[model samples]
Target: MGDLNAKVGREYDGFQGTIGKFGIGVRNDNRRRLLELCGASGLSITNTYFNHKLEHKTTWVSPNGLVQNLIDYVIVNQKWKKSILDTRTFRGCRRVPSDHKLVISKIRIKIQANQEKRRTIKFDVDNLRNERVKQQYEVKVGGKFAALIGMENMDMDSEESWAILSSDTKDVATEVLGYKRINSKPWFSDEAKVLSEEQQRLRVQVDDKQDLEKKQQLKRRRNRKLRELSDRMKHDQNMFWKERATKVAVAMEIGESRAMFAAVRFLRNASQEKVWRGVHGMLDEDGNLVTDEMEKRNLFARYFERLLNVDTTRYWDKKKKKSIADLNEALEVQEEDISAKR
Candidate 1:
C-alpha cells in the first residue's frame, strides 16, 4: 500500500476489478502506467472498494480550493483484496502542511504456521546441449546399463527388472547432468544485491543518528543506492530479453524446429495462454465425463485394457480378406511385367 500519486480515473476499462468506478478525475499517462504495474504485480486499488462521498474519497486539494482529486492510493495484491476491511480519507481539525489528506486502510491477513518444503534441485538441462555434456551423459548411461545387464542375469520378476532399469537410468542422468543452485530472484544481479544491502545499512544508520544533517546525508546515500539498484535491474532485464531474441532468431534461421517453437512461445503472447495443468476428465462407458481422479484413472485403465485385448479374429470377414489378397497379387504381377518391359 502506497501513495503512488496516480490519478486512476472513474473509468476502469482495462483495469476491471483492479481499479473501481469511484476513482476521482480522469486517468492520465501516470494512471495508465500505475494500472499496468498493478496488473503485472497482481495488485488492486483498495480505496475504490468502499462507496464514499467525494470529501472522503479526495486525497488532495489545490491551495485555491478550486480543484480536488484522489491522487493517493492504497493498492494491495489482488488475492488479498478481500482482506482489506475498509479504506477512507480522514481530515484533522488542525491545519496540516501538506496538500494531501491522510488516507488510512484496515487490512487483515493470516500467516500460515507451517512452512513449505524447500525445492533444492534446479536442473541445468540447457547445459546438456553441449557436445561434451552429451558424451558424458551417454558414458554414464552406458555404465549403468552394463550394471543392469549383470542384474538381468539374476533371476528376477518382470516388475523388478523394469524397476531396476528405470531407477538406474534416472540415477545416471541425475549424476552426470547435475542441477545448479536455484536463484529465487534471478533478475536481481550481484551488483543490485550489494547495492540493496548497502542501502539497508545506510537506512539503519539514518535511523540511529540524532543529528538532522547527518541523518539527511545518510538518507541521500540510501536513496542513491536504491536508484542505482533499480537502474541495474532494468538494464539486466533489457539485456536478458535482447540475448533471448537473438537466440530465437538464430533458431528460426537454422530450421531447428523444436528450439524455434520454444523460443517463439517464450517471446510471443502465446506464453500467457492457459495450459492444462492437471489430469483431463475422461468419458466413461455411459458417455458422461468422470472428473474424480480415481474414477477417471480406473475408467481409462478399463478402456485401454478392453481396447487392446479385443477379438481381432472375429472382426474381419474372410470374403473381404480374400479380395484384398487377390488385388495385391494382381498389382505385384503388373508391376513385375512393367519392370521387365522397361
Candidate 2:
C-alpha cells in the first residue's frame, strides 16, 4: 500500500505465508521488519505473489538508472488474498516526476446492493392551467366527493374521511395532470462531442503506438484534436450562458417571477451536476481509484469507524504508564522542596 523501502528479496523461508517466492533482491533489516509485521497481522505481500517482467516488478529506480528496486508493496489480509488479481508497476506513466514507478493492483471484490434512493413525487400541476384538463380534474374529484357524501351515514372516523379524500384527489391529479418529466440539455453541441471523441481516439492510438515516430505523430494529432475540442467547448459554453442570460432578462422584463426563478434554478442545477460528475469517484487508501457507489460508501463507513474508535493501548502500555508515574513522582519531590524553601 506504500513505499516502506523494504527489500524483501526472493526468500520466503520461515515467512512463507507473508512473503512470496517472486520477490527480487536481497533481504534487509527493513524487509525483516516488514515480514514480521505481515506475519503478525496475518497479511500477505500481494506484489510478490504475482509473477511479472522485471520492468513491471521494480517500483523505484536510481537517479542514474543503473539500479532498480522493489520498495513499494501492496499488502492485504490473508482472508482477501485471493482478491488480488494482479499487482505491478506502470513505468509508462508520466503524470508524476519521480524515480518511483506507479504501483497498481487489480482487485476484485463482491459488491452488495446499495440502498435505493427515495424518489420525490412531482405532479405536472402546471398542466392545470389548461381549461380542459382543469375541468376534467374538477369533474372527477367532484364525483368522488359526491359518492363520499352519500356514505356520511356510515359513521366513518375523521382519519378515514381524510384518507379517502386524499386518495381521491391524488387519483384525479394522476389521471389529468400526469407526472413532470425532467430533461436537461447539454451545454456542448454535436460538433464539440465529435471533436471530443476524435481526441480520445487519437489518445488511445498514441498510447498503443510502439514506434517512436508514429507515436510522436499520433501525440501531435491528439494534441491538435484536444485544442480544437477545447475551443469548441468554450464556444458552446459561452453560447449556452448567453442564451440563459437572455431568457432570464426577458422573464424579468415581463415580470414573470416563476420563469425567472426557473431559469435561475436551472443554472444552479447545471453547475451542481458538473461538480457532481467531476467528483463521482475518489481514490481509496491504497491510491486506487474507486468508482462503485457501494464501495465508496463502505470506504467512508470504514474511515469514520476507524476515526471515531481509536485504540490507544499500543501508546498507553505498561512501560509508558510506569515512565509517566516516575516523572510525576520526580515533579512532586521538586515541588515539595520548593515549598519547603518558601
Candidate 3:
C-alpha cells in the first residue's frame, strides 16, 4: 500500500467520515491554523473514532445527516468556495472487520489555473472633480481656448496659497477632499514641530514630577507615623512606671500591697541623706515605727528611709545602722574591759 502523504489535519469526533485516516492525532493546532489561513469560513465538519489498538481493523462511516450538516455549514456561512458533490463509504475497507465504513468525500474545491480579474481602462474625469466644479466641469467646454488655466479662474489650491491661509494645520481643508496635499502643501515649520515635541516632553516631565512628589509625601507620612509610635512608646513606659510607683505608695498607706516597691521609690525620691526602708506601721508605746520584727530584723528594720531614693538593701542598712553600730561598739568595750580587769 502507498502512503497518501496528505498531512493529518483538524479532527472531530461523533461523525464517521474521518475515522480510518492514519496519523490522526487529537493534539495539533497546526491543522487549525492551516484551515484558517486557507480563508476557511463557516463550518467544515467531520466525525471520527478509532480503536486504541491496531489489531482491530480501521473503520470510517459517514451518515447522511453528517454529510448534510457539513453542507449546511458551508451554505450558512458561505465559505469553502467549493461544493461537496458526493460522499462514498466502504463497509470496512477490504480486510477490516470493524462494523463502520471508510468514508471519502468528493469535493469541488479544485479550481482553474488562471483566476480572473478586471482588465479595463478608460479616461473619464468625474471621479476626480471638486465640489464646486461638479455642475461646471460636467459641461467640459474646453475645446481649444484652454483659458490660460490658473490665473484668476482656477481654485487657490497650492502650498503657497494654503500657507498664506493659516499657520495652524487644523485650519487646512485636507480631510474633506482626500489624502494630504503633500505635493502642493506647505512644509511644517521647524518651530511648530519643536513646540509640538516640547508639549509632549513637558507632559512626561510633569508626570515624573508628580510621581516624585507622591513618593516624598509617602515617605513623610511613614516618618510621621513612626515618630508618633515612638512617642507613644515613651509615654507608655512613663505611665507604667508612674502607675507602679503610685500603687506602691497607696499599698504602703493602707497595707494593701507589698511595701517593697514604695520603699524603693521613697529612696529614689529622697535626698541623699534621707532613706526609707522596711514596712512602716503605726508607732507602738515606745513611739517608734514598727514592722514584722523577725524577717525585718535585719538592719532594714531600724529606720524609715525615703522610698523613692532607697535601693532596698542599702536603705535597709541605713535603717538599722544605730543598732549595728551599738552592737559593734559594745563588743569592742567588752573586750577592752576584760583585758583591763585581767
Task: List lDDT for all candidates, in order.
Answer: 0.78, 0.86, 0.42
lDDT of 3 by residue, 1-342 (tens): 111212233244331232223223333444444335323444333221222232222233244424211111111123542365533344445575433445555566667789688855332343346666443433333311233243436566677555543332222222222343222112223443454455455555555665777657655655565565545444443343444455666777887654666557553654343222322334544654434335245435444444445568876788699789999999999999999999
TM-score of 2: 0.37
Off by over 4 Å in 3: 1-42, 46-78, 81-83, 110-342
What TM-score should be assigned to candidate 1? 0.40
Task: Using TM-score, give the best candidate's number.
Answer: 1
Tell me how candidate 2 scores on lDDT.
0.86
* Candidate ranking (TM-score, best to worst): 1, 2, 3
TM-score (all chains, Cα) for each model: 0.40, 0.37, 0.18
Reference-based lDDT, residue 37, model 2:
92
Across 1-342, the per-residue lDDT of candidate 1 in tens digits comes to 566778887887777878877777877778878888888889899888788988899888888978888888888888888899989988672275888888889878888789889977656777788999889988888887888788867899999988888888777667877777655444457787898889989989999999999999989888899899877766665455555666887888888989878877765743343322232345689875554556767987998999999877755777678889999999999999999999
Q: After superposition, how far is residue 39 of candidate 3 from its true place, in Å?
A: 16
CA RMSD per model (angstroms): 27.1, 23.2, 36.4
The Cα error of candidate 1 at residue 269, in Å, is: 6.3
Top candidate, metric lDDT: 2
Per-residue lDDT of model 2, residues 1-342, tens digit only: 999999999988898878788999877889878988999999999989989999999999999999999999999999999888999999899587899999999999998899999999899999989998889988999999999999999989999999999999899889889998764536769998899899889888888889999999999888898889877766665566667767888999999999999998976777555523422346689976555556778999989999999987887797798999999999999999999999
